[model samples]
Target: MSDNPMPSSFDGNPEFKEETAGQKLRRRLREEPLIPLGCAATSYALYRAYRSMKAKDSVELNRMFRARIYAQAFTLLAVVAGGMYYKNERQQRKEFERALEARKQQEKRDAWLRELEIRDKEDRDWRERHAAIEAAAKEAAKGGPRPAPAAAASAMASDQSRTAEAPVEVSEEKKKGGVLDAVKSLLSGGK
Candidate 1:
């Protein structure tokens, strides 16, 4: 006979094997209800204390004094345990909220980065196309004889002088001051 106990078929399965802390707590609570018992013990101790107080004899007052004290102590411990459990729950909720917010912020940053990358790629493609067009234009211009630097400068100067000497012609409505003239005349009482 083997010293070790035989393993059950269910033991091989992970789902059937291990219990979580919450599950263990639920099982323990179901098996033995302590909190209610503590409350009852406390109430019984208080009643006993009240009875002892009412009793005139010192012997009667001394009866089961230790049991009453023990009951009160257990009740105090139970209340403290409940307070600790509440604090833990609150802390867990706050941590979960903070983590969720951080995840949302991270997702927003990732989306913004993707948008920037797409725009940058489009700009790069446009620049490449523009550079290719400029290169082709230069290659085509190579067939023609280039003008002298001094002649080019003089031609540009003459063009600028011609433009400067010519008077700029305004449209009929623009020269007449359009809506502004009408508004001014109305405001000035036909003056």
Candidate 2:
């Protein structure tokens, strides 16, 4: 085995070496600090102090103290304002997320309802087709005996009669007599 590493084919590829100026700038910016608030606050405080001391009088000391106090107050206010803004932004983000979730749920519900409606319509159509086929079968059966339209009507009537005459078995417990018999026995004298 050789101690030297094998050269990859991509080493000679021109596409790997291609990079635009904008890409390089973006890479540099990404590597830089994101927020420079520390430097900005220090610079602002120093500038305010410099302006406050510029006045040369006994009142200048008072003004400098007041300016310093004002600077402190402003710094505190800015901190508080920034905190409140961030809190409000977070709340707004939560509300937007909730609204998006609710919209998704509503869309899912609507899709389900549409699917159910389509299924119901298909079921109704199937039942209607089945009934028509049954009617046609009956007509054809009757026409086998007599080749007239009246025979089909007679066959339908016969089918209705046969269905009506079919005996329906009722259980002894459900013969509509259990409760009534008990009531009757109670009304009678210990029968």
Candidate 3:
């Protein structure tokens, strides 16, 4: 009885894996075939040599012994060749992986730099707006004649004292020192 049953068709069974004789042979051959071939040849030659000795045939025994040595040498050479190929493949794969990682890191760094530049530009714009507001305030102070600080405070207090249905926020314009004083301050500045 078979422990594993291979489905006849994949249409009926998704897990079914169908392989033709040639496909199986090619796959097996690609999976390091030389060493196994050497081993088989060596074992057959040794068996033949044993049988020749049993039959009391010295010439056949000598020939089989030589064949066994040649087979072993072939297997050794195959193993060495396979090892070299494996090492070369591994080194190339490692180099490819390293290059891929470096490219990903470079992309990440470029994104970070772009984000930093955007933030810096935003900060620069904000500072320029603030400086312009300060310049306007200074110009207003230099204008003809300005009311005293005490009068200004009194007028602000009177405005706050006005009756209203809801509690209104006071002096919203100068809340964060963003814009000029009075009506001009109310006309500008969001942040």
Candidate 4:
């Protein structure tokens, strides 16, 4: 049979398939056929030798025995050659498998790198927003004119946009004191 299975209506058992003896022989002939032929020849020669012995024919018995030995030798050679062919076939299959596995691993690494790049971008944006807020608070503390209330509302709107899909996870730096501490410092003005 070919390396791939042939689709069929019969999905009964994956391990078993129904086929007549003739069909089986035809399939065998399509793959390493010489070994099967050699085995058949050996079996026939042995059968004839047994028959000749039973008939009390010494000359025919000797000839059949010699034929059986020759057939057995041919079968042995055929088996060794088939083994060598299969070894090469198995090596090729292993190489194909290794290459497939390597490709999958590379895809996984690429995906991980992409995720890291996104996280880095988010972290940079978070830091820039905090720095802008701190600067505004410092200016207000020094008795400068405050930013318009609408500007504060727009900043809040931008924060909400970042959480459109889900809550923004607190990053490593945010986990130290957090946005609450920043808000407190802004309202209290270092007191």
lDDT for predicted candidate 2 compared with the true structure: 0.52
Per-model root-mean-square deviation over C-alphas: 26.6, 27.4, 20.9, 17.4
User: Cα deviation of 127 in candidate 1 (Å)?
Assistant: 0.8
lDDT of 2 at 34: 29
TM-score of 4: 0.40
Poorest 10 consecutive residues by lDDT, candidate 2 = 2-11
Q: Worst ten-residue run, lDDT, model 4?
A: 2-11
Clashes of 2: 0
Best by TM-score: 4
Clashing pairs in 1: none
lDDT per residue as tens, model 4, 21-137: 897578657757888888899899889989999999889989989998899899899888877877865465455545546656767755765455445445556787789788889
Q: Show pairs that collide, candidate 4.
A: none
lDDT of each: 0.57, 0.52, 0.63, 0.67
Q: After superposition, how far is residue 99 of candidate 3 from its true place, in Å?
A: 18
- Deviation of model 3 at 74, angstroms: 0.5
Per-prediction TM-score to the true structure, in the order listed: 0.31, 0.33, 0.33, 0.40
Q: Model 3 lDDT vs. the true structure?
A: 0.63
State the lDDT at 67 in candidate 1: 66
Q: List, residue by residue over 17-62, the lDDT tens digit for candidate 1.
A: 3456898678646644666687688677667766877876556556
lDDT of 2 by residue, 107-178 (tens): 776576545444444444456556865777787788743345687567556655644554322343235334
